[model samples]
Target: MEWFLFQLFRTELIHREHPSSPMRSTAQQTSSEIFLAAVKRGAKRRARLSQKILAAGKIFSTPIASGNGEYLIDLSFGSPPQKASAIVDTGSDLIWVQCLPCQSCYTAIRAKFDPTKSSSYAAGLPYQSCNTSCQYNYMYGDDSSTSGALSFDSITIRTSTITNVAFGCGHRNLGTFAGAGGLMGLGQGPLSLISQAGAITSKIFSYCLVPLGINKTSPMYIGDSAAAGSDIAYTPLLNNIVNPSFYYVGLTGISVAGKAVNYPAGTFSIDTSGQGGFILDSGTTLTYLNTAAFTAVVAREAPRRPTLPWCFISLVWISPSLPLPPENIFVAVDTLGSDCLAMAASTGFSILGNIQQQNHWIVHGIVNKQVGFKTENIETI
Candidate 1:
């Protein structure tokens, strides 16, 4: 069945599984409902990686670290393009950030939230009517319980500084993410930046991420969308439960420890918002691979797991990849040499999350109605 990308309501959501690592600190929030309403349904096909490492004329964002161990994005909102520091999350849909006169502020960062700041900042920008079934609330179970407000405004990127595009400042914001100011929701919605840009007739997309442990040349961009161009190739968007149309990047390849694997890591991906422990995230601190895949890695490194009864699960790298991994679940990555897909899941196997995605630039692109990926700058690659 082809997953379709339609309007998003509050009733669709899914829970994420925990990681393989036993002792780690992560967020307390967990989603249990499955979200497939907005999935872009299509058949999967094979594709090659783009020869270019980085796409030309790319669109990106400048992500800042929050006390919550997550990255905060500078979402464009309000009049004259006031950039607010919000979390660039794919897990949820309500993209909200702290309003003017925040309770606290970033040390080196500044938010220009002036109610009277610009000609575009009109008092009471008016709420949008949910005509397309695009109602959203920020509650845990697919119900946009948070029920953020919809204030219309103009937003510009720091690069070209384009003026006056249809953007929104979330109605409500929570300072939960490690001293985070707010959030920039990246899910499929009318509120997403994707639906805001007036410049392109076709759909435009952008991502702002900082490679973990790499701290130089963190840049963001606008227009000249990489996902829309061919310089960066892509495969078809999946219609599965695990990898919704959340922009999965096809991997040209992946390596375990210090050696490059022969087969490429096919497109089974998603851009999770901010994951602490037992969650998915951008720039997640570690790489969490499938137990079989990860155990193969561990055996290569430590040879064998601790001689405990359930210390480590024995796994083999599944040569043939699946179009979709699974649904309503996430896999956890235990240490390299651990046992039985060490998941906190009392039910099924481990669901893959961020632990398997550390130290990599997972990219996204669209070509001939498809998306793809290619990992770069590794000891093995």
Candidate 2:
């Protein structure tokens, strides 16, 4: 579980790769075409996730907005290290992969992971209710699901290997996974990779998200190596009893171009029932604000022409303020330089998404109950 660095690629870019080539070519499409396509897909993903958050209320369940992840990583599982790709998701818990003997599976997957081929694979757990093997079933909001035996095995990322890792060997997987082998859950839950390997990771990790259009892989650091440096800015990490897996933050206020936007108090606060709050999620592509706050921000910033090169939107997190440049707040809609707001209004809760996180070294300091941020040129890492 020693801290290690691994490459993270956009899912769309990976899909565009030719079966015989490792190079992730865009199939000759222009950068604008790829960016616009990603934006449209992100809009669909946002709508699905918003629906689940609004309807779930206090009822908690592992919900995967499958096939819509913005980023993915390549890793290996079991002995001999059979290569596999998984979606890196901070919104849900439970690491899983499609196993052999799949009753129903997505045809897009290159190959099914056969647990029997690995010598280190083990089934069942002490807490499992089954007499012989542990069984797991996860249902998503979009009617996608994976169900199979709960087991443990060796997982390798780069040169770092961790043994006896808990994961679900999915025998029945049905969904639009977009050719991914499975999902790597980075949430704050017992089944998440971070929690399962907490002894080594110290429940801490950090990542630098690159833009979707960029073909270069981004870097992800885990364990002690992810510790924030002196230049990092820290903010309180709130806990939600209703949904403990999510990483919640304190969003106090917002300002556009140094001008404060008037919004009602507690607009971003998690209520006693855990109804509304602000969360930082890597799986979500675009940022989402609560209806009231979203309206205020749009009304304040919308008057400016979209062609402007500068739009500094600062998000006040308790005592610290994180300013987002125009590139992070606005997305290109056409080659003519017309841009659109890269955020949406949410009826349930607000989320700081990946688009708003590019080029920033974000550290999730779980043990200390605080998240840290440091601006850096991630491509140089």
Candidate 3:
């Protein structure tokens, strides 16, 4: 049987042994928790970016803190193939998993990668060298870091076994990543999976993350399967000369309740200096805007005193008492203590996070240098 190399969904915590698990009753509240965590994580990422801008005069890819990205993918590694779950992040490079002989590592939900058990383990690939024994130390904005040996081994995703896959075998790992074992680099970097497997993926990838709480599965597609239909809205992908590893998108403006909130032109533009502009980060749970842009958006959205509807069990109903616009289901104020739209008070750049990207077919077209978005339903996807 040929395992088609397409469509991996978010890993559910309740049922790890079964592939099909029904969305739990507390899914809506769980979604809110995830969103709030993403907001906090995004702020940390912004701080790190600001520091890089001030010190190095250029930006670089940084590992997102835990609770930022919500997408979870499952794959296997080594000769016998140890199954593991990883956070899918488009902002950071370096696909890594906790390895054996851990010096200081967080507890993983699954078994750690053991190179000795793998027959195809190689001493080196391009970035991960086994011969000379390369080491990678990646520090996050939150002060958490991962240090490990860089090496090569075969990785299996579905039916496809990608050979000579370069990845980090983390021995010293710490942070708030509670359930996930490691990270899968979907970013636009040399060490990222997309770049490493460019010959097979053809520089294309797409994903439709099913809204949190929904029982449906979200699928990630690579290569020709990532193409979008004509109805999808497209924007050109901007180049960040300072950090070529990130996927920058041109964000003209934002609309609330069908009204355009005006901000200065080039508020989200990236000039030759490699500053400003927005990124489409699957790892970030909430959308983030620069101070000026965020303030303007909040002013426009705060005035609406509408009631938001929520679903309980399998039924959806309107909650007239809730003080939020129907369109902004994820928005919260004061009592709920979560931002319907998060603000980036710490950084100059804006981010189009995954919260705003829910129930949408998001495409990353490297060859075309464009990103496309199309509204979708979880059931249909």
Candidate 4:
């Protein structure tokens, strides 16, 4: 099997809809699964955001896509190489998978990795002093959790085979990861796949998420392979002091119908304290803004409309012939025949979700701490 230390792979989103038809039913179930996973991820993020705010003045100033469905890619671990598909997530760190001798686990579509079978599997990590046997336990917003031992083994990605790569050998696992074996977290944390890749990957990656229901392969590139051209627009990646794990971007203002809306300046500012800003998250399905900004945008986008959902519906009736704002700022939900962007109001921070990121080339330059966006269709090409 060929693999790259840093490789590029194509992925597709799954949808489950229409119970009458078998294919459609499967797609519908997949869609529901994706939606539920996204909701749980959103709730988890919101709770973390709230925790950061509550701990602000005190000692604990803390913490805190691509497709309408989950983004998955194939990877292998161990010496003999137990190959399995894993979800590519940017919201959380720590790449983990269910291992064999399972005490309890979800109904997996692939064979689980057995550390005992791999000749290169090391039961303990050198980083530990006394209890070198690595172990981890994590819980998510949807009440799902996983507990397992850490293993240092050979991991193969295409043509590149890396040794001593640390990953979780999950024994007790649960949650929405049914069709996939585990999650490959690409978040900006210490334990993420990107971070673990270390000098081999050059701290860079890029992805182009296909729209929902598009049965095509979307691509993800690592290292120098993620090049860009002049047609791409670049945005400065901002830092959220409280939540360094997220990819924050400066969102100056939003415009509608080719004219700037009447929202205040500091609406999306990142001050010294890292309060009030927006982040681009691939795990989230819908864009979200502060309640104030969301309300104003809704009012202007559909004036005389009382509620947000109603306003969105009203936009569908508006003449498409009318010129609209640039897509990077305002996204039109064509599936609903509506000009309204699929965004909502939040109390903590604004989020640029995968819904708005569709069909765009998103480059994450972790080394430079900047993110670049370009509008293009890599799927068809």
Candidate 5:
């Protein structure tokens, strides 16, 4: 069997609708289970996101894509490798954990960063030469602004002992990221733990996740030659975007209340970096929509809800019904609201997140410029 590690993030902030409800129903459970069972085949998935990040409690945080963050990972650093609470992200790839000296390591309720701890502590960091020698000064807005110089140390998870995790050490405070310790930049570069490991040797790095929206049945796939479904649905990649080596997916179509509205048929882009709004990002924290897209979805979802309100949480919203089951999924919410109900608009459902992609097999063909989306049993491609 192959080896991998799971990492978790302690997310405390979210932008969700304000309404509350009882626990998910058995019917919902049945649906979720059916969807997830098909997605999870022979792989194990770990937690990869923070527990406190969701506005509507853990449910909203369920099926988190990239917004859930890297709560777990494949045993790259070499340690037994902790469990994951992940948000399968793609915009970037540099798996790491919050270490000690964590001035602002996410919410206090979540895991605290302790540098003094980790038996694998390898220090002698140079913080000043970051932007010039490192990536950039601007971390993503969604990321916890604890920016600083990137570290060139070896971190070992269990499955594959990754050296030079591309992990960043924080400054005295969060210069950019809101209040998080450090981040695990997971893309296709040295920043990626797997990719970095691959650099040292010739091993390829990859990963996957199990979705809660799928009733904790489906397993998202990463690394190796692992993939879930056959009769999958895939959309072609757009003409232009950022990095071609990115774990890019495709934009199938965007609908408003079951009505298909064309955004030029090829306007969507997939980013594992966990950047951007709701239109194409599966790994983002919130389901942000462009003005036109948001308007259309909201109008269809909550026709009766008020247009503008004082607080973002007080709005009524329509939950989107999915054609596919959950699993093979990642959920998203509003700006950073603590309530999922508030983020809902007149759209048939909230932004299509981990909830809609349930039971579907998704593939981030990093080497290719396309994503493969497939139903567990039905091969769309």
Candidate 6:
């Protein structure tokens, strides 16, 4: 078993010649403009995901890929360890990478993984011991798809090496990955990297997201290092049988300032049909609340800052009262010259996105089925 720490960088920083360069865009734009654009894009993508989940009435076991997510991590695969950059997605399962003999792949990818080059590469699961290769086809909600063989190899994260890791060797992949080779799925699913490497990771992981535009790499801890500190708050993770991959929390209600926003008893709960619930998603940039809840919260917070239409206060989650400061709740829109709420309204499902998670040391205690949070300056950590 191995445990170590690694760096988590935002995908937008990949092509930047300098820290201030525009993210995911060819045109010159200010940092504020880039921030606004990314937030809007994430909100739209999240809406689509919510709809897809509701339409299917369950979280897809195959998992949907969010193209060019906000954060990514560098990983090394194979025996000697071939380097590759992959999106870090807590919303999806299945760690995969673009492999050689590609039917279709992103032209921007500088290096395509050649499994044959690795001495440790194996065709399928070790338990299977079958002569035939295990094939997989993953279709995302946004039409992006990847078809590959279920393969085994060594994956290196920082200095720690985890052997016999299961990952997809994507022969055919189609998506706007922004040069990323593939995705590292951290979702609570059987096929997720955490689950596959449970023996070494101890089914524990934690990450502290740096504030946007900080030009700093965040820290992700695995195994014993990921345990919650004394100052952290613990919340039981709700189980959604239909959508078991997602991390659902017990959200009683939200409060603006000291006042609690009015909403129904089970507004944030997953119904018998698994329709509506609140999930913590690392892939989504902005937080989303159920329409009714959103309206109530906004109505209370927006009135405080009449001059700044978009300005809103922090959200205090009841029961445990996890407070998110204004810095984590708002995004500066350069054009408007005012901060906008980094939140949106969803029809049913709600998400606690990355923006709201900034500077928070979030621990996912998989074995205990709990999540812990503590405020900390991520850059220092």
Question: Per-candidate TM vs. native?
Answer: 0.49, 0.89, 0.79, 0.77, 0.49, 0.88
Please provide, for model 3 over 130-213, each residue's C-alpha lDDT reduced to its tens digit, 9 standing for 90 to 100: 466888888766777788988898788766676778899989998745457788888788888887767766677877766544
> Given candidate 6, what's the lDDT at residue 251?
85
List model 2 lDDT by residue over 75-122, tens digit each: 889898888878777877889988888888886445778888999998
What tens digits encode model 4's per-residue C-alpha lDDT throughout 1-381? 444555444333332222211113243344434444555555565655455543555673234211112456667888888887776777667778889889999876678888889999886567655246777877654456778887788877655676777788899987656457787788777777777765677667777776654565566766653554455455566666655767877666665544555666677766666566777777666677888878887777665333433222211101111111234333433446344455778765677777567767787877777777776764554
Q: What is the C-alpha lDDT of each candidate?
A: 0.32, 0.76, 0.64, 0.63, 0.34, 0.74
The best-first sequence of candidates by lDDT reads: 2, 6, 3, 4, 5, 1
**Candidate closer to the true structure by TM-score (higher is better), 4 or 6:** 6
The runs of at least 3 residues in candidate 2 whose Cα sits more than 4 Å from the true structure, single-residue gaps closed, are 1-28, 57-67, 225-229
Error of 1 at 51 (Å): 38
- Relative to the true structure, candidate 2 has a C-alpha RMSD (angstroms) of 3.8
Q: Give lDDT for model 6.
A: 0.74
TM-score of decoy 3: 0.79
Cα lDDT tens digits, model 5, 139-211, are 3333433344445444543333444355655433333221222344445555564355442333222222233
**lDDT (Cα, 0-100) at 98 in candidate 5:** 46
User: Candidate 1 overall Cα lDDT vs. reference?
Assistant: 0.32
**Candidate 1 residue 305 C-alpha distance from true site, Å:** 11
Candidate 1 regions off by >4 Å? 1-69, 100-118, 121-137, 140-148, 161-172, 198-211, 220-222, 225-233, 241-245, 248-283, 290-301, 304-361, 366-369, 375-381
